[model samples]
Target chain A: MRDVAIIGAGMIPFGRRDEDTLMDMLAYASLKALDDAGLGDKSVDAVYVGNMGGGMLQRQTAIASSLVDRLNLMPAAAETVENGPASGGSAVKNGLLAVASGYYDYVLVVGGEKMREVTGWRATDFVATMTHPQAEYPYGITLPGMAGMFTRLYMEKYGVTREHLLAISLKNQEMGTLNPYAHVEMALDRGGIFDSPHAIVNNPTSADPLHLYDLCPVSDGAAALILCPLEMAKKLAKPPILIAGFGQATDTQTLQERDDPTDLKAVTLAAQKAFEMAKLKPGDIHVAELHDAFTILEIAESEHVGFFKKGEGGKAAAAGKTRLGGQMPINISGGLKARGHPVGATGVAQVVDIVFQLRHELPKNRQVQKAENGLTVNFGGFGNNVLAFVLRRVQS
Target chain B: MKKEIAITAYKCKKCGKLHYPYHDRCLACKSREFEQIKPQGNAKLLTYTAIFNLPWGFDQRFLILGVAEFENKIKAMGQIKADSVDQLKVGMKMKPSWEPIRVQYGEDVYGLKFEPME
Candidate 1:
């Protein structure tokens, strides 16, 4: 099989986009990617749309067809992929394979979710639909609840403290203030959020052991990427970031079923597979974006992905190892914590951020110095399903 | 009359790995055949959390939820019978009961509820 490389990457600012419909967001992001590729009215071989809640929230289905028509890209094959929160990553995976297999020369992969269209309660319920229908859903288990339970277990087993979690919250939010595309631009203060008496009102408990700041905000946004063969991408003016390796894995539907709830086996396996395929260990990665839907998740994923030893991820964050300019800068784009997780958009947005880093286009504050390789982990359903990708900057 | 737990656990005939919410095949050995068994005796609290921002269906301000393992090795999610999560602890003994955990369509929905066995 041929190698795949990202030629174009684009995304809109993430936040409460009440004005744009799901279809509109998809179309807009696709157009930006198309223009960025300098394709200038050229048609792609296929279009892959990653979305999770169009049917549930907008009462819309066959979104791929709608997006293709909206973008005036008729006659190209169109398909919509749904993999819970990993929909964006799954769509990119599909596009990568299509191009690598030589079946499609150019593929447009876009992921978007207009979650802000619904109230917070309805959106929470919509996300909870990913839980086990019989065992979890009927019991009203939301994603934060799952994270809260996981956080409790991690604390008990690893001795992770609230200080560790606070470190991630502060670091990511500070980075978010510098990321124009991030949903939350406000930097959090320790006194207002934790140290002061006003902390209770500023950071209330959404789930036990995890405060409001620990969770990503519900958002509406879209991101897109243009993928083609590595050979073709070499002709472009900018450095083409190669999709060197990718991995996806799944675990038991419910957390209780796993032998050890704290052991995110899927995360470990997925990252291992990606690293193996890339022929590079985690230590070789210069910058990374982990699935930090919850503060605790960033810590857990860091350990599972082998960036740090188990039980040390939390401490690593506290010591600033994961911050930009540190040993390994994580979530320079602010991650899901500050960038906002629009489910379907997140996976594509992550790759887009990595592409920006590889291209050396970002301002120094958000860009890693002399970055060469980047990795992304898109988690779904509380660690049950996860996708990992390793991207490398190929000198043009 | 004591109400039954109203839950069926499947034990892999080949691997003896017990599963709740019945899997089509055993996760361990992938055995197709299994024996149905009822959860026996009290349970041990494994992990729990009190969720404040509930979904649309839940009306209460907060709900205490947890996963507990029964004596028969059947693990499941249940509503913890406590005012606050402060009373819950991991590895603590809990008394399991089959009762109404929620209301649906103005009708009582029976499910698992765990009370601290202190």
Candidate 2:
């Protein structure tokens, strides 16, 4: 595969945009990315969108075609990629492949979800569709409930404490406060987590061991990125972020079939592949964006991807190792927990943050100083599918 | 009418693997040869979720229960009509039971659920 580079990245603020339609948000982000790249809509050879619930949310199918029409890129091939919450990452991967394979000179990748427009109960149903339809969905295993189960087991098996989970939230919120685009940027203390007004009102105990604050909010937003071959990328307005390594893997969809729920083998394998391809080690990475849909996920993911030792992620967080300005900053965008999880838009948003940090364009407060290398890990449906990408700043 | 909770599964004649919530083809061997096999013995609850919120078309009657390795190593999710969320715990023993999930569009759909084993 030819070397592919990210020429431009753009995102709408991660939060509830009740006034904007899904297409409106996508258009905004895509236009911004195109303009940033000094390209026009006609330059895009194809478009790949990551959307999981256009059908459930708005009863809108054929979303790819709709985007193509709305963007006025009629001649360009348009497709929608869905892999549960990992939709964003998968779409970005496809766009990377398109550019790498020389199939297109330039490709547009966008992820958007208008979740808050639907009723909360309906939103639950839409998210539940990620599970086995015949078994899990029929019984009602929402994502939070599954995370709750995982959290309880991790605590019992690994001695992870509830306070550890709370600490994860507190730290992410601190990072989120530094992030201008984060959905919930307000900082909170451990006591405030369980007793805060937000907790009392919106975050009632949805599941045992997981309060509202411990979970990622249902949000609506969009993120977009422009991909091109290495030769063309250097000509763009901003410094190019090279796709150094990319890897993806899948596992059994049913959680029971997995040998160990505590160990995300798919994530481990994907990360290893990415690191090997990049010829870089975990220590070489300066920054990271992990899929932290829940607090426990951040802990589990940090360990699974070799950032911290197993069962030591929580302690590392307690020690502030993963915080900004620490050994390796994580979720500087507040993560899904605070940045808001718009499902399809999450993966692209992670890449956007990486681009900003690598370009030294991020607000000084959230920026990681001299961030030259970055990684993004996007997992679909509780580890059923995972995609990992490593990006490096191209030295002029 | 109080009915005893039973665990039902389908065994593939080709791979000799058991599948929950019967299917036409065996997931293991991808074979059509199968027979209904009642999973014997009880299952340990690997993990569970107490859903305080119910989705649309679901009754506000019970908490959503997601159990792993239940009834022949099958993962299942269903409405668990237990007395309280405290009654649910990871590693707790459970028995499979069939209950009416909901009447969707005037059709009653029955699904397999798990209740705490005393």
Q: Largest DockQ belongs to which candidate?
A: 1
* Tens digits of lDDT, candidate 1, A1-396: 899999999999999998899988998899989988988899999999999999999999999999889888899999999999999999999998899899999999999999999899999999999998878887888999999999999999999999999999999999999998999998999899999999999999999999999999999999999999999889998899999989999999899999899999999999999998889899999999999999999999999999999999999999999999999899999999999999999999999999999889999989999899999999999898899999999976
Model 2 agreement with the true structure over A1-396: per-residue lDDT tens digits: 889999888888978898998888888889888888878645689999999988878788878788878888888999999888999999999999888898898899999999999888889888888887776676666777778777777888888877778777888888888776788978876555565565566556776667777888889989999999989888766899998988888877776656677778889989999999888998889999999898888888889889988999888887888888999788888989888899999999989989988998987778899999999999889888998999999987
Q: Which stretches of candidate 1 lie over 4 Å from their true place?
A: none
DockQ (Cα-based) for each candidate: 0.83, 0.58
Clashing pairs in 1: none
TM for every model, in the order presented, reads: 0.99, 0.92
Off by over 4 Å in 2: A40-42, A195-203, B1-8, B12-15, B21-35, B59-64, B68-75
Clashes of 2: 2
Give the CAPRI rating of model 2: medium
For candidate 2, give the lDDT of residue A27. Answer: 84
Instruction: Give the lDDT of residue A217 in candidate 2.
Output: 82
